[model samples]
Target: GCLPISIIGLLVETTHLSLVTPVGWWLLVYSTVVQFCIAYVSWFAALARLPASVAAIGTMAVPVIGVVASAIALGEPLGAGQIAALVFTLAAVVLATR
Candidate 1:
């Protein structure tokens, strides 16, 4: 998903590569290893063990959690439309689980 964008970014910003500090490089490596590799492996392992319906519910909740987390952590707004969507998503998950 990120490959094309990453390639384009690298190509365009090649000249500015020297601006990345050691900390930035370390963070990049850490995030790539932990978030991409470890997280995906753990998620797939969980998926393999979980029932399909349960996994589906968990997958559906990801966006809801992201939105709510962004609101709380990043001070992102949760206006009426977002609130309504959240409500509907939760309602659907509840209905599906039953």
Candidate 2:
């Protein structure tokens, strides 16, 4: 029922995740949930400490972090083009937050 909708909710619901077993996948999701919980609290704290506009600017790094993490953790390919884009994006994000 909810599976299809949840699948749509995922950013990279692709062939890669299919290689892992159900239990292994659940463990990964549990770990991610824990990390997200920690990050959520920290981000909330950061929001309180900084101006909303500053927080908005800093939030742009989330995609860069996601790409790097996914490439490292899942062995996803981060081609030269993608790497260049990530670098530029992050550089822009740094400039934006400054």
Write one digit per residue (lDDT tens) for candidate 1, span 49-81: 998788788777988999999999999999999
Top TM-score: which candidate number? 1
lDDT value, residue 37 of candidate 2: 93
For model 2, what is the C-alpha lDDT against the true structure? 0.85
Candidate 2 runs further than 4 Å off: 1-37
Each model's backbone clash number: 0, 0
Q: Model 1, stretches more than 4 Å misplaced? A: 9-15
Q: For every model shown, what is its TM-score relative to the native structure? A: 0.77, 0.56
* Model 2 Cα shift for residue 93 (angstroms): 0.8
Model 1: weakest 10-residue lDDT segment is 9-18
